[model samples]
Target chain A: MLLLRIASTHVRNRLRQTIVSTLGVALGVGFSVAMASLMEGSQRDFMTTLIEAIPHVEILDEKRNPAEQPATALYDAVAFHGLRPLEDLRGIRNPTEAIASLREWIDGDFAQRLSGQSVLRYSGQDIGMTLVGVVPGRELKVSKIREDMRAGSFEALDATANGLVIGRKAAERLGAELGDTVTLTSANGIAKRFKIVGLFHTGITTSDEGLAYAPLKAVQILLEKPDIINSISVRLADINDATRIAARAERQLGYKAVSWEEANEGLMEAFVVRNAIMYTVVGAILVVAGFGIFNIVSTIVHEKARDIAILKSLGFPETDIQQIFVLEGLVIGVLGAIAGCGLGFGLSSYLATVKFEVTTDIEMTRLPIHFSYVHYVLACLLALFSSGIAGLIPARKAAKLNPVDIIRGAT
Target chain B: MIAAQPQTGTDTSPLLQTRKLTRILPAVVPVTLVQDVDFSVGTSEFVAITGPSGSGKSSLLYLLGLLDRPTSGEVLIEGCGTADLSSAEMASMRLAKIGFVFQFHFLLPEFTALENIMIPMQKLGRLSAHAQLEHATGLLVDLGLEDFLHRRPAQLSGGQRQRVAVARALANSPDLILADEPTGSLDSAATEQVFESLQAIVETQKTTVVAVTHDMDLAGRMQRRVHLVDGRIDYDRVQS
Candidate 1:
């Protein structure tokens, strides 16, 4: 208690230096927290955007391993050429039954889809595009296409027997509009007539110009792959269950499944690297703040040489002397951490309100800041650790001071 | 003074004894500050160590106070050898049984006189906070500085500061008090006040007093004197 008293008295006597050093630590902690919030905020924004535009989990008709002939498997160095097999459709054979079985455990909406390359001919204009077939009512629950529609309703596909929806750009190139009858001829030469029921603008070049949608059963028959669906799109209530659900679904259904995170692997890797760099920068700033503590503590030890000698002569041991200076550093560090957390909250909140729309051409958004207690806890721990070491060096020096040497001249 | 004559206690062992103590600076050129010196003082005996500049009076007192270790030989408190004790143990012994007063008062500039006097007792940790306060207040009253208890060292005059330093020295009620020119920096009036205060402690409290002084007039008043010349004892004799 006496040592604490002595340390606090020393700090109180040097008010200006104490304030300056504490502010140095405060600035370091405050800025690091704000930077962390900003960086984490942007990463979260990108994830939400990616998750919104696609299914949380997509189970495809593709196999994890490619089909190989028996001869190819038997020979390691030699390849077997041209063994043609009978035509058999590659798709989930009983789509409704499989979906019904999966729905017993997983809580989500599921939609069946069939897709293929096709040529659309309307009034003599022809355009090549990918035609995707879907059950209109169920598809809307699993995809964001409902929001992209510029004209006609997704529900109208249920009423109209041969309804189709095409993007705004694709319909323009084919010279077709809502209510126009068009002919879609698949790659295998089977043709069908469908009336355009809806138009959409997705802001994606490929999808807007080269994609069309029709009722699933109609496309299944037109492609000559009756009673088969190539893919199942799932939108779970909790997005975090995507990976586990996708893995279980793939194992059970014997099809390759992909989660949203797996689809954006490269972008997620970039985020990890960004986070590592951010933490390093914040740690370096705290270390620099530690130097400020080291400087002020060293000055106190130098200035209080006589007082140290006097204490030594009063029968205080070297360990007690060491403790006093270290305590001083801790006191300053604690005060600075409290002040820094307050400042960070204020700065981050102010940042969160600023409209950060770079240009009107893109979506308008506010500057993002993720506020969490973890950030404050981490910053304070770093500040305290650094200052504790900072205070120790001078304290050791002060403890080793020879009282006889200092008091000789004064006596 | 105070109706008590100069007499050494008849205990079998001296309160403080030195066996050929020596100290060397051990610098690049190696200065020998205090050569082999044998000394002893009994309980209730007031002894003065007088020498000219650099004659090792202060050096000898520092060795006796355990502020400096002797290069050879040893110091004994209650006839127990201090050579093998750890520095921490020595510090503990000093806190429990010895006190020091310097020429400059050396009171911490931030603490008041009463708080300064309470420091040694607080370090010893043998008394409660309330008891420490009461004892510190009682020491100031005995030294006639009751009005100056709340004043810092800087606020007090030279004599007042030295008396506060004296009260601090007595905080733990040690067996022996060592003063290195306790009145050297004061004027005639303040010097007389501090001298009488030390004399009162020796007479009323029976605490042994050992002082290092350049002022012969003050040295001559003690019951015994040890004269040192070039770190060697020239004489150790009683005033009678």
Candidate 2:
């Protein structure tokens, strides 16, 4: 109740300074929220694009040696049971051992593969291709790999041996197409011919230009690396459980299991750095606004020294007097945070609809703005807290004043 | 030096009592401003402390008013020692029992006359909003400031502002009213008017009044006058 009266008195007495201080804080908060929204939106968009283009998890060698492939223990366990490594198993050991293990394990004395997903690998000349020996029906689980198919059906793998799906850029570079014969030269210098039954284009420039898909057995025979695979890819029931499942797969397979974030560390780091820089810039604006609030409050305390003395002589406690100024700051802070939130939301949404032309070496296009609610809330809280903290110094000084000295002017 | 005996006819406890009230001016040698002064005011008595400039008349009033603690003495209000009270308790006691009027008419410039009067009562936290408003209005009316209740101090004349301050001082109906040269800054006519109002409140409410004044005419009209010379009481007299 005392705070309410103090707040009222503060508003009544320092109207102009209060308004200006609130505006300063609002500007700070608005800038912070808008920048945060843009940063968060950009990050979310980057992650979404990357995730849509690749598997959420990918297995790689744990050795940290680029030359070493992922271990085949889990892959072999799934294959030895006559089960496809990617489809049926939660994880796999050696590619062929997985097939044999699935058959034995299902007879009941041991844990069986979760499902029957296939894994196959093939190498062409010094250029190795990870032949994702996928089941025809469940191939869409691999994401844009299926979406990018420009011709022929994913079912083409079920009907024909030595059939291949070549990327659009790869086909263009190799002068190959649907139903055209392409010779794949293996790592051992063994050459084999395969019919390109499909064409695909992954929108991402790098992958569309390089990746190729083939049936498991055909590639294995062609490369003469039968019952062997470089790695296995498994689709989890809960996509968000990817990290935990990857850890479990690592422990079971004695091989490295990687989440999409690990697979694209460079992109993730770029996103994180971009967010940090944006927040730092926005934070500088808030710091400047906080200083503005501090200055205004200090001046108010100086100007009202006599008035404060009178109130204190009337038996107002130091805490009560301090509360008045603190309340003044809170009023300014709350008003500013609220105003900033409104302005930031409106501005961010407006910007989200605006398409700005951006030019880069790869392509030039207009991109629409984007915003996030979490960033808006964070900015409001930061502004309010900073303004409140800024009020503290002046409030303490005001509280410590000698009422008699202030009233008598040095007597 | 004959010691004065405590009068038994009055209430056993005085409304305000100061023993050896002293104040030291901050200086190289710490000049003694007022010292070894014993003073007491009974309920319903109007006492005046009169002295020349630098005689410590205001310092004496301040000590009795509980606005400032004495350098080496004790102020007892209604038999309770003030030195032992915590800051909060002292404030509460002041709010409940002491009213102060300074020469400058220190009414808050931003608040209306009525709001200024409402301050002490608000501090006491004893009055409801409607009651506080009513009591403030009553005090303003009693002080002949009903018309000026809504006016800010800046909008008022020096006499009017002092009247409002007096009204505010009496708002909580304190047991003792202390005025330090309350009319010192006012013209002669304004001074007379302020004095008349103070006298009227004391006569009707039976409130103890202790005023520090250089105006001998004003001091002579009080029930008792104590003249101070060099921090000690030179003459203490009571008049019929």
Candidate 3:
């Protein structure tokens, strides 16, 4: 108690020194908090866009490698005695059962779908595309296509027997408009005229120009494989649980279930590197502030040699003297951390309101700032630890001070 | 390097004893500050160490108060040798059994007179805060500083501050009070006041008091005197 009293008195008496040290720590911590918020906010925005734009898990037919097609037999069997006719193979069998199994595994929702590469011819222009056949209601529950729609609706596609929902860029490239009919040709050369009933814009080049959605039954009819689907898209209650649930679903359903994280491993690795850099840069600032604290504390200890001697002469041990100075530094750090938290929150909120479009599919038009209490708490603890260490060096110096030397010099 | 054995629980034994005490300033060329000097003081004794500047009078007092360790031999407090004590142990030993008053008052300027007096008692931690306050208050009151208890050192006169320092020294009620030129910075009138306060404390509390002073008049008032010259005791005598 006496040490604290003494320490507080010294701090109160030396207002300028205390303020300088406190401000040093405050600026460092404040900057760290702001950076933390920015990084966290950006990470959150990226994750949200990722989760919203795609299925958390997709269970595809394990036997089909979408990248390869089954080769056709070169020689056609002649109509001869004892020659058997080749049977036509469909997509994943028992789609309803697979969909039900996936729905049971996923907490939120799931969709059964079929996908095939095709070409759409609009007037004189033709473009390569991957057409996904989705049930409109279930697709809406599983993906953010509904939210990203720039024109028309999924219900329109559902109602129109030969309707297509195409991206804005695809519509532009194909010169297709709502109510206009486009010639869609399946990979097997089966062709049909489908109306462009809706358009969506996700601002992602890959999705915008290469993806088209149509009604499931209509696509099956165009492909001449009715009621057959190749994949199940599942949305989970917790996006983070996708990997584990996907693993379990793959095991139980005998389908290859790919989690979003597994699909975006490269992006996740990049994010990890980015976060490491962000924390390192911000953590350096706090370390610099710690050095400032160390400098000030050292100066104070040098200045207080006489006082230290006097206390020592009064029978105060080295530990007591050390505690006093250490307490002083800790007090400064704690107060600075509190002030920085407030400043950081204010800065983060202000920065969050600054609108700017990132030239990416981040789905945000404002600076993202996730003001997590965890970040604030972590920043404060770091500041405290650093400043405590800073204080300790000088406190040890004060403790090791020779009272006789100081007193002898004073006299 | 033989350590002296400590004698315990004996009345009428000298309260402090220094046997063949020597101190050398360890340096490139070592200089002896005090050499093989033997000294002792009894209970209720008012002794003055008189010497010219650089005669190592303050060094001897520091050695006696356990502020400095002797290069050889031992200084015993209440018949207990302090030769092998750790720094912390020596500090506690000083805190419990010895007090020091420096020439400059050294009354930590940040604290009030009351707070300054409470420092040693608080460090000793034998008394509760309430009791410490009571004892600190009583010490200041005894020093006739009842009115200036809440004032800082800067607000007090030189004499008042030195008296506060004396009060601080007595906070733990030690057996011996060591003052290194306690009245060296004061005017004659303030000097007498400090001297009388210390005198009354010694007579009433029966605590042994050892002081280093250049003032022959003050030294004459002590019951005993040990005069130092060039790091050695030139004379030791009793005043009749």
* Residue pair clashes in candidate 1: none
Those runs of model 2 whose alpha carbons end farther than 4 Å from true positions after fitting are: A59-137, A147-163, A171-181, A194-205, A250-256, A261-284, A357-377, B1-11
Chain A only TM-scores, each candidate in turn: 0.85, 0.74, 0.89
TM-score of each: 0.90, 0.82, 0.92
Task: Please estimate how well model 3 matches the true structure, expressed as its whole-model Cα lDDT.
Answer: 0.88
Instruction: Tell how far residue A243 is off in model 1, in angstroms.
Output: 3.3
RMSD of 1: 5.2
* Residue runs of model 1 more than 4 Å from their true location after superposition: A68-88, A118-130, A147-152, A160-212, A221-224, A358-362, B1-11
Better of 2 and 3 by TM-score: 3
- Worst window of 10 by summed lDDT in candidate 3 chain A: A64-73
Q: Which residue runs of candidate 3 sit more than 4 Å off their true CA positions?
A: A63-90, A103-106, A224-226, A238-240, A358-364, B5-9
**lDDT by residue (tens digit), candidate 2, B6-80:** 333335887877777777777888977789888777888888999888787877776776667667777778766
Per-residue lDDT tens digits for candidate 1, residues A103-130, read 9988999999999889999889888978
Error of 3 at B85 (Å): 1.1
Best-fitting candidate, scored by DockQ: 3
CAPRI verdict (incorrect, acceptable, medium, high) for model 3:
high
RMSD of candidate 3 to the truth, in angstroms, is: 4.9
CAPRI rating of model 1: medium
lDDT of 2 by residue, A1-411 (tens): 755575567666777887888888888888777777776777677677777665665554343332222335536444243433343222333654642433342221111111211221233322334344454544555555666678886668667787777677667665656787766655556666677788887666655665566676666665565555555555444567667766765665566777666778888788778878887888788878888778877887888888677777677777877877777677777888888888887777876776644433243342334666677677877776777778777988998887766756733
